[model samples]
Every structure is written in structure tokens, then in C-alpha cells.
Target: MHLLFIADPLHSFKIYKDTTFAMMREAYRRGHTLSVCEPQHITWQRGSRVSAQVLGITLTGDPTQWYEAQPLRRAELKDFDAVLMRKDPPFDSEYFYATHLLEQAERDGARVFNKPRALRDHPEKLAIMEFPEFIGPTLVTRDAQDIRRFHAEHQDIILKPLDGMGGMGIFRVGPDGLNLGSITETLNRHGAQSVMVQKFLPEIVDGDKRVLIIGGKPVPFCLARIPQGSEVRGNLAAGGKGVARPLSDRDWEIGNALGPVLQERGLLLAGVDVIGDCVTEINVTSPTCFQEIFDQTGCDVAKLFIDALELAISAGD
Candidate 1:
């Protein structure tokens, strides 16, 4: 089978922790051809079939030189056996445009995993709103007054931009509310942009768990991102400690509850974020932490994903 992964540039991959790189390695080991292209490489002019300038690639043992690419070739989306959308987020206008192109490919009979429309429909931070029972006090608004009201209602709260990833733009305002007005303006652009405010989960001290759901089931273990020093964010990009452990019962329950619904919606993989028993985010676009859990637990998450991918392909046939 030939697999085409639409993702970040292959040269930019940090193999030790990049989930896309891990998937490539696992796929190559299983004798499947691999091709890669950045989102910008996709082009669909007047009469074209939504093709891409894709480069066939092979993996190397050396981490620094992980991929060797062949000359670029243009292929219609239907040419590949599977297409994995593994682009990281800032899900801005460009990212949004990429999904529309991929969705056109899907219509042309390309099997794109974690389906494009699903990605657009479920923005990470606001996705948890689908399950109010699983979330804490949350507000999504651009109004400074609304944020102030929410903060007043919940003394400790977290404010963040809905499009932000990797702990960026996250601020915790406590009882003192020293910089509430300023933060509201900065995050919201003074009533122009929307921002999210949720009650701060004190259980963050324990860890912010990333529970990966693939092919409609839980991974059995999770990578807990524990905040460092005075930081309130438990994102690995923010220098949080990644500790892998077995999934807690509550975690399993949440995963099981959401898995089937997500699968039905064409989301093949999801990384559900949890602090204590409440889900804080449902990461559909480029959900990560596969390597961290593997390095600690010896559970080959990449292999699991590949196996599921193969099954999905065969079932599609």
C-alpha cells in the first residue's frame, strides 16, 4: 500500500517525539511506500483533480537525517491508498483552506484519516463544549464584560485563544485578578476576537493527561504532562515533564464514552485532554504524545496506529 502523509516538512521532524515521523517509520517497516508533502504543496487549478507535488521518502536510522526524499512527482489524491492529515495547528486561514482542499480530495475518493470536515468542525479548545457534562465552567466569547463576569463567578480561571496550540496564549487569573482587564483586551482584541475562559482545574498540579483515542478505542495508557516551576500550563512545548502511566478509571470512562461518537463522525484518532475528571480539550487536529508513551511504557503506539490504518483500508475495500 502507498501512504501519503500531508504534514509539516519532513526536514523539520524531530523523530524522537514527532508522531508523524513515528507513523512513517512504522509504515515503512511494514513495506508500504511513503510519500510526504506540506499543505502548501497541494494545488487544484481549474480542471485538475486536487493533486499534490509529493516526494517519495524513506526512513533512516539516524535521527538527524531521518528521511531521504526522491524527486517530487505530481499525483492525484486518489492515487494513494491512504492520506493522513497530520498537520499541526494554529488552524488559521491557511490551515482552514488546506482542509477544504483535502475535503475535495475526500470527495474524489481519497481516504483521508481524521477526516477534514471533522477537523474543521471540532476546534480543539471548544470541542469539549459538545460534552458539557464532562467539562467545567467554560465561556467562549469576545466580550471583556462577559469574561469579567465569568471570572467573577469562578475566582480561578484560565483564558486562552481558541486557535492556540502548545501552551501558547494561556493565562491563569486567580482571586486577586490583578491583570484581568488587560488580559481580556489582549486575548480578545477588545471585542473583535473570540477567546475561551474556563474555571482553572486545580488538579493540574497532579498532571494534565493526554488520553489518545485511536480507531474508536482508548490506548490504555496516557502521557501526563506535569507543569514545571510556576507555570500553569502542562504542555510539553512549555517544558512540562512527560510521565507515562496507565489510564485512570475515570479517564477510561471518558475515553470510552467519547470514542464511538468521534469515530462515527469520521475522526479516526483524537487526543482528549483531561485535568482531574473534567475534559479540557479534544484535540482532533494533530493529536500527539505517541512517542512519549512508547518510550516509557514500551507500547508501540505507531504500530497500533498503522494496524488500525491497514484495517480501515481493507474495510474500505
Candidate 2:
């Protein structure tokens, strides 16, 4: 299979931690041709046809380092069996534009995992709000007064940008926590972008779980990311420790409810974060953790992803 990955630059990937690189390496090992491109490289020519400068990728033991095939424009992306939208995010306008292009490719018979329309509809933080029963007390708003009221009610709250990923701009405020006015100002100053304020789950002290789901099924390994001292964010990017473990019953229930919906929407792969059994985020765009899970449990999560992708392609055909 010839696969095109629309993602960040190949060289910038941290070999040890990047799931994209791990999957690319596995795809190569399976003798699937892998092509790489950043979001900006994708464009639609004519009315609805899409094309990108697809570079063949070769991954070695060191994930950071990779060799590339001569860069070339794939005049018709439909030629590739699948295109993995693996770009990391702040979920900005450019990312949306890339999805629009990918949606065009889908219309032209190219299978795009995590279907373009679904990706557009499902922003990580906002999507999980659909299942309030499974989540913690959460509020999304930009109004300072509302935020203050929420803070007053909850006392301790977690604030995060609506569109940010990798734990960027996540903050925790305790009862005596200061800077509510300043934090509200900062978040509101950035246009109408809302911030998520949730009751801080102290159970997070035990670390948060990142559960991977492929083809509507939970993978065997879940990584408990323990944040460093005085940090509220448990993201691996935030210097947290990744420890592998099996899913608890609650984890299975979360997956059972979320899996079919995600697969139905064409999200073949996702990373759902749970803090004390409360679903926090449904990570669709470029969900990581495969390497961490593999390193800790010797599970080849990359294979699960590839198997799902193959099934998606075959079913589409």
C-alpha cells in the first residue's frame, strides 16, 4: 500500500517519543510505501482534486533521523491507498484548510482516516463535552464573569485553551490560587477563542491515562503520564513520565461507548485521556503514545493502527 502522511516535518520528530515515526517505520517494514508532507504542502487544483509534495520516508532505529525519497507532487492523491492526517496541532485555520483538502480527496475516492468532516466537527476538548456524564464538571466560555463564577463554584479549576494540544497553556488554580483576572484576560484577549475550565481532579495525582482506540477497539496498553512536581499537566510533552498499564473497567466502558461513535465518524485511531475515570479529551488529530506504550509493554501499537487502516481501505474498496 502506498500511504501519504500529512504531518509535521520528518526531521523534527523526536524518535524516542513520536508515534508518527513509529507508525511510519512499521508501515515501511510491512513494505508499504510511505510518503510525507506538511499541511501547507497540500493543495487543491482544478475544482476538487488534491495534490501534495509526497516524499518517501525511511525510518531507522533512531526515530529522530529518517531518510526521504525525492520530493515529488502527487498530482492525484487518489493514487495512494490511504492518507494519514498526522499533523500535531493548535487546530488553527491552516489545519482546517488541510482537512478541507483531504475531504476533497475522500470525495475523489482516497481513504482518509479520521474522516475530514469528522475531524472538522470534533475538536479534541469540545468533542468530549458531548458525553458530559462520562466527564468531569466542565465549562467552556470566554466571558470573564462566567469564568469567575465557575472558579468561585469549583474553587480549584483546570484552565486550558480550547484548541491547544500537547498540554500547552494548561493551568491549575487552587482555592488560594491567584491570577484569575490575568488568566481570564490572557485567554479572552486572543479573540473569541474559549477556554475549558473544569474542576481539578485530585485523582490526577495518580497520573492521567492515555487510552488508544483503533477501529472501535481499545488497544491493550494504556500509559499513565505522571506530571512533574507542581505541574498540573500530565502530557508527555510537559515532561511527564509514561508508565504502561492495563485498562481498568471504567477505561473499557469509556472505550465501549466512544469507540463505535468514533469509528462511525471515520476516526480509525484516537487517544482518549481519562483522569480518574472521567474522560477529558478525545484526541483525533495525530494522537501520540504508541512509542511510550511500546517501550513500556513491548506492544506494537503501530501494527494495530496499520491493521485498522488496511481494514478501512479494504472496506472502502
Candidate 3:
């Protein structure tokens, strides 16, 4: 299969722990040619097909230089066997527009993994609301009064901006509610921005586990991103220590329940963030942790992903 990865720049990848690099390497190992492009490379002229400035790359085993690639060439998006939207987010307006172009590509018969419309539909933070049983008591609002009410009821609550990633702009308001008004102002922007408020789970001290779902089935192992020192955010990017572990019963239950359903909904890959027994987030836009799990547990996540991708492509054919 010839795979085109709509991702960040090839030179910017930290290949050591990057899951997109992991997928590219696995696809190369399986004798599939791979091309890469940033989301901004996409273009759709008035009557021409959706196209992109893409570069076909060969994997180099060298650690410092991971890929050997040619110059960017314009290519029709529908020409590839699969288009993998693997860009990490701020998921801002630019990302939103890229999805529209990909949606058009899909209409031109491009088989994109995790589907464009699905990505647009399931905004990571908002998607959790659908599976209320697996999450803690949560509220979404920009109104200061509503947030205060939720914090008053929950006592200890977590506050976060809806557009944040890597745990940016997250706050914890306890019984004393220190900086509550200020934090609300910063996050909600005087009711112009919406933020998510959830009852703070005591179980976060254990670890925030990332359960990978490929082809709607949960991987047996997960990366438990343990918070270091006083930091409350357990994201690896936020200085959390990633430790791979077997899935707990609750982890298994949540992953299994969400996996097939999300797949049926056209999200082929997902990283469900599990804090204790409850799921905190469903990562659809480039879900990660493939390398951490494989390095720690030898679970072969990349292979599983490629196998699933192959199956999906074959099914489409």
C-alpha cells in the first residue's frame, strides 16, 4: 500500500517516542511506500481535485536521521491507497479547514483513516460527554456563575479550556477555591470561551493511562503516564513519567465498550485517557503511545496498527 501521512513536517518529528514515526516505520517495514505532508499542504482549486504537496519517504534506521525523502511534489489526494491524518493538535481553525479539504478528497474516493467528518464531529473534549457513565460528573460552560455552581457542588474540581492539549490551561479548584475567579476569567475569557469542569478524581495520583484502540479493539497494554512531584497533569508532554502496564479491569471495560462503537462511527484509531476507572478523554486526532507501550511491554503496537490499516484498506477495496 502507498500511504500518505498528513502530519507535521518530517524534520520536526522526535522519532524516539513519536507514534506517527512509529506508523511510518512499520508501514515501510511491511514494504508499503509512504508519503508525508503537513495539513497546510492541502489545496483545492476551483475545478481540480483535492491535492497536496507531498513527499514520498524511505525510512532510514539511523536514529538522528529517520527518513530519506525527496522534494515536495503536487499529488492528488485520492491517488494514495490510504491517507492517514496524523497531525497533532491545537486543532484550531487551520486544522478545521484542512479537514474540509480532506472531506472533499474523501468524496473523490480517497480512503482516509479515522475519517475526516468523524474528526470534525468528535472534538476530543466534547466527545467524552457522549459516554457519561465512563466519566466523572462534568459540566461545559463559559459562564462564571455556572462554573462556580459546579465547583461549589463538586468541592474539588478540575477546570480546563476546551481547546487545550498536553494539559495546557488546566486548573484545580479545591474547597478553598483559591484563584477561582481569576482562573475562571483566564479560562473562560469573560464568557467568550467554554471550558470543561469535572469533579477532581483522587485516583489521578495512581496514573493517567492511555488505552489504544486499533480497529475497535483495545490493546492489552497501556502507557500509564504518572504525574511527577506536585504537578496535577499526567500528560507525558507535561513531565509525566510514562510507565507501561497491563490494563486494569475498568480500563478493559471502558476500552472494549468504546472501541467497536467508535470504529463503527468511523474512528479507526483512538487513545482513550483513563484516570483510575473513569475515562477523561477520547483522543481521536492522532492518538499516541505506540512506542512507549511497545518499548516497555513488547506489545508490537505498530504492527497491530498496520495490520488494522491493511484490513481497512482491503475492506474498502
Best by lDDT: 1
Query: Model 1: per-residue lDDT, tens digit, 13-88?
Result: 8888999988988999999999988899998887778899999988877777777889999999888999999989
For 1-317, candidate 2 gives per-residue lDDT tens digits of 99888888866877777888788888889899878888888778687578877777665555334564665666567888888898888889988888888888888878887789989999999998799889999999888888889989999998888878778888887897599878877776744767889999998888899999999999977999998898888888898888899899999999989999898888899989999979999999888889888888889899988888888898883
Q: List the lowest-lDDT window of 10 residues for candidate 3.
A: 63-72
Per residue, candidate 3 scores C-alpha lDDT tens digits across 177-210 of 9999999999999999999999999888888999
Candidate 2 regions off by >4 Å? Answer: 60-65
| Total residue pair clashes for candidate 2 | 2
RMSD of each: 1.0, 1.8, 0.9
Model 3 TM:
0.98
Residue pair clashes in candidate 3: none
Give each model a TM-score. 0.98, 0.95, 0.98
Identify the runs in model 1 with alpha carbons over 4 angstroms from their true place: none
Clashes of each: 0, 2, 0
Best-to-worst TM-score order: 3, 1, 2
Error of 3 at 106 (Å): 0.6
